[model samples]
Target: MRKEVFVAEQRVPEDLEYDEFDAGALHVLAVREDGVALGTGRLLYGEAAVGRTGGDPSVGSLGRLAVRKDARGLGVGVELVRGIEAAARGLGLAAVDLHAQTSASGFYERLGYAGYGDEFHEAGIAHRAMRRSL
Candidate 1:
């Protein structure tokens, strides 16, 4: 499902979409009434998020957030974000961090995330670091 959105639709390189942390990241999947996946996201905490969170154990890293075009305008993306935040809180995290595509930074800001740091590129798409304190 993530491949469908990230690799196929968004043009993110497959090699960059999947990484070493997948095995330990907490993944969340959104499905339809028929069990067809519509969106997905991942949460990385503790050691998994240390590098991304500036070595802060209390901050979880949220990444690989994707929602199928057919499901856009619906609340799947928001739900996935909320779910990731819940997972972070469950792990005793104080906040959640993410590298948001600059074009989508407003979407995350609407959900309470505040962007920081200079813009950078990941998988060929411009991005900005964003975070929200739980």
Candidate 2:
């Protein structure tokens, strides 16, 4: 799913789409009743999340959120993010942070995430750091 959205559609380098953190992150996948995967996301906590969470142990990093082309606008992305946040809360996390693509920042904002700092580029795409208290 990450490959389909990030690597292929978004043109993010394939190597950068999958990283060391994936090995330790808590992944969430949204599926239909028939078992078709609709979207996916991941939560990174503990030491693995330090870099993304600004060294805050009580926070988790949410990443790799992607929805299949056919599943876009069907609430798949929202559920995937909620699932990741629920997992973070289960781990005792106080908050969740994500690097959202600039174009998608409004979506996160609607979900209660507030953006901070200047915009930055990741994989040649404009992004903003956003956070929400759990």
Clashes of each: 0, 0
Compared to the true structure, candidate 1 yields what TM-score? 0.97
> Against the true structure, what is each candidate's TM-score?
0.97, 0.98
After superposition, the stretches of candidate 2 with alpha carbons farther than 4 Å from their true spots are none
lDDT of 2 by residue, 36-69 (tens): 9999999999999999989999999999999999
Extract clashing residue pairs from model 1: none
The number of residue pairs in model 1 that clash at the backbone is 0
List all candidate RMSDs to the true structure.
Answer: 0.7, 0.6
Alpha carbon lDDT of each predicted model = 0.94, 0.94
Q: Candidate 2 versus the native: TM-score?
A: 0.98
